[model samples]
Target: MISVKNISKTFKLYQSPSDRLKEIILHRSYHRVFQALNNVSFEVKQGETLGIIGENGAGKSTILKILTGILMPDRGSVNIDGKITGLLELGTGFNAEFSGLDNIFHNATYLGLSRNDIEKKLDEIIEFTELHEFINEPIKTYSSGMVMRLAFSVAIHADPNAFVVDEALSVGDAYFQQKCMQKIKAFKNNGGSIIFVSHDSNAVKILCDEAILLEGGNVVQQADPETIINTYNFLIAKRSKGEDIRYQGDDTSSGYGNYMVRIDDVSLQDENNNPSEILISGRPAKIVIRLAGEETIDDLTVGIGIRDKFGQDIYGTNSFHLKKKICIKKGQILLIEYYFKEFNVGPGKYTVSVALHTGDTHVNECFHWLDKSVAFEVVAGGDDIFIGFVRLKPDFHIKSETGNKDD
Candidate 1:
């Protein structure tokens, strides 16, 4: 378990090296103070995973460094129940000139393992990395992903009571990432505490028990993974528009945009055009998005995303993909309806996320984006028995043919 209380850190930035000398001589302040973290506090109990997410320069790295003892906070305190390890960045605590095998021994020894203990766990670590062929290769010769594999392998095998993982896990390939996630899950099941920092919302939602959002060195919100991720998205949208940043606090829906277009309302409807919180599988349904224009805009593409209860995206599409372009003038109210002839998804609770942007994606010029605007459940009444999140309407054919028997 890990506990952090009212932690704060600040850095002094100088415009030039000469300013430091001048400040010392004149006993004057010649550096600008940058608050990297301010009163940040959180806890990770045994068997729980806490995720930290924020934009760049929001003190995510600073907080991690403090938690891992790499940097000292100017105020507050941190307490760890047992040995803690961290995977902060690629090649951290590694000697570039040393071979992978040598680095394994080196890192394990640093983790408080005896030579005998290192020898016993050496093979297991190497096998987990799948780097047997390159175990003797110099660390300088390995790729970034390879270094990440070696580092993560050694860190996890150190048998730490709690581990802090930054964005280092994002370096490896998808297969290795999945392998690491499985290992993390096993560790969590064994009552290990984890503090994961990443920009991957889906991974955080799937793995974390709770999460916190940081902005400008302050903890903006702390809550369940779903709520944190929604607020994070909203924060990004607000940043893109140069708007004042504040926590929306509403988990049901968080909306943000440039104000040129506003998502006034969103609703899920059934075949009879009645609002519904429940929909039937393989039945006709529609999502109605009401938009009010604050200014004239062209090249607008409206999109919708369907996410499962776990926050995994099921489907997403935009008007650009459908070859539709919209233009709205000031005071114009538009009602966009997406009709589904067959909602062929399995029975489950899902949410509808709507966005109004330019071009094909919301990466640039996002006029409005609303997350979890509406929610509905799909029932199994109209569809055949299916076992997964989606129905493919598979067609099967059986043919009988007799072939010559082999001698």
Candidate 2:
């Protein structure tokens, strides 16, 4: 268990040596202060995996460092009920000059493992990482991926009560990632607690039971993993739209993929093909997505998601699920319509996003088409009192009237 209360971290930025010299030389009192975290707080129950997410410089790593005692907060406290092993950064808690084998022993000891205990698990760690050939080599000579594998192997093998992980597991190849996921699942299933921090939505959806969204060093929202990821995607969408409100590094763009896909429009209507903004709960609704292909797309599949105003994904559908082929010619215009019963969804404004993905690949081939277009709301005047993204009412009745005697 972990409890963070009013945790805040502040740093001082000095312009130059002269600024510091002047402060001491002339006894000046002026100083510049930077607030990294401001009154941030959260609680993680035992055996819970809480996904910590935020934009760059949003105090995500800061919180992790504070929790692991790597960095001290300027104010507030972090109460951790058990021992913690953190893989916050690559090559952080190891001796680079030492051999991988030596560093493994060193790191294991740092994680509170006795030399004999570490020796007992040494073969398992080496086998899990598949780094036995390079185990004797200097850690500095190891590649980034190799080092990450060794580091993770040592940490998880120590069997700590709590885990603090960043994006460190993403360094290795796909095979290693799969192994790490399996290991993490096994660890959590064995009642070990984990605090996973990452920007990958899929990882959060798969591993985390709950999540917290941080914005500008503040806690903006906290909820289920699906809701947290949806809200984070919405924030990313706003940044991509070049909205007026900008967070740190919002203007920076990365060369993600060779090709990019964008959604032009999203509409919802009835069977008559007439566009209707409002829909009654528990009715059938058709969602139409219009997408434009900027380049020649081969074997393209579209994945669509519907989310509420709070950024909770109510439903997700994709063409791949239907085992359909998507061969779009160069600069082709396409319309994709998904029909489903709109049951269990509460009344709220929702946004629809469509992603152009390569067939059979889990990764989205194109830049995520998140919050591409906003749709209208569904009123909650139905008899069911369910409050969720969808409204599904299952029928339940007595099978035999004779068996059901009148009261």
Candidate 3:
């Protein structure tokens, strides 16, 4: 098992090397302190995976380096029982001028594997990487993907009791990445402890049983993988806009529209009628919307679209699209509901947006419209499974035709 107790690290920023000498001569401070970690704490339990997620300067890499014994913390302590291996900062242990095969032995030994251990796993590592002829060439001549394959193969074959990885899977081709994920899954199933640090939220949600969110050198939230990832996205959205998105009910929703009609309330619910910002994939999606006509409504059409985090349209339909025009006078109220029996969409964060407009010609003449009025998420579940934003289940069977003479 691997554990970190209130670990923290800080660095001194100096203008130049002369500043250090001047400070020593003057017997006073000449640099500013920057805290990269602030009393952070977490642990990786045996037979489980713990995911650490954050932005570039959120101290995630610092934690990983500490776990791998590459860096020491100025404060706090780290506890470990068995050997720990890490796949971090790819291409670090490799000599640019050395051949791939030579680097394999060099790096694996650097990771604490004995010559016998290396010999036992050497063939499997080379075959898994599939570098074949290129394995004899200098690492500097290999592509970024080949380097990843080699580094990852060496790290995994070391077969430590505990492992630490920092975005190591975000390399190579899609097939190779999947292969890595499968290997990680096997490791987990075999009772090996893992500390996975990555920005790929979907992978975190799928692989990690527990997760932690970090911000500005502090522990923001730590809980189930889905909730932590959602909180991280919310924090990112706030940072991206230079403002905090106001949340009325634990959901960060924001939008704008015209001056005529107004969207009063919007929510996403399951078939049980329980409201939540999360929807299970392949389950029913029940959407409810209430609108109020603030001004006179004339020649108007209203539309609703479920979009992914990128604002790409996932599913959309409108009263106008169905030829069901909504004509209401000023001060009137409107209530609308949509039910989807099988919301077979893949896992992802989604938002429901609404728009009120007029004219059949070009969708101009806007009355009121709110983009991303209600934000929600879709999680994985159900039968045939795969990756991507959309899910289409396929059937498989073999049919046979018997001869006319026999039955």
Which pairs of residues clash in candidate 3, taking residues 3 or more apart in a chain or in different chains?
A: none
Which is the winner by lDDT between candidate 1 and candidate 2?
1
Judging by TM-score against the true structure, name the best candidate: 1
- Model 2 per-residue lDDT tens digits across residues 1-407: 88899999987778776788788888875579878899998887777899989889888888988988889998998988878886888888899899999998898998899999999999999998888888999988999999999988888888778888898778888988898889888888877788899987768877888899998889988987766665675565455444422222112111122234445677888546679888667777788878677676667777877766545556776778878877666678888878765534677877675666665432434333444354677887648877766566677665556788343
Q: Select the stronger candidate by TM-score from 1 and 2.
A: 1
* Residues 1-407, model 1: lDDT tens digits: 89999999999999999999999999999999999999999999999999999999999989888877889999999999998887887888899999999999998888788999999998899999999999999999999999999999988999899998999999999999999999999999999999999999889999999999999999999999988887787777666656633333263687766768888999989988899989988889999999999889987899999999998888999999999989998999999999999988889999999988888876567787788888899998743788788877776655556644433
Instruction: Give candidate 3's TM-score.
Output: 0.69
Give the lDDT of residue 380 in candidate 1: 89
Per-candidate total of colliding backbone pairs = 0, 9, 0
Residue-level lDDT of model 3, residues 29-94, one tens digit each, is 999998989898888888899989999989998888888888899999999868788778979789
CA lDDT, candidate 1, residue 55: 93
Q: Candidates sorted by lDDT, descending order?
A: 1, 3, 2
Whole-model lDDT, model 1: 0.89
RMSD of each: 3.4, 13.3, 8.4
- The segments of candidate 3 whose C-alpha lies over 4 angstroms from its true place after superposition are 21-28, 240-244, 248-288, 291-407
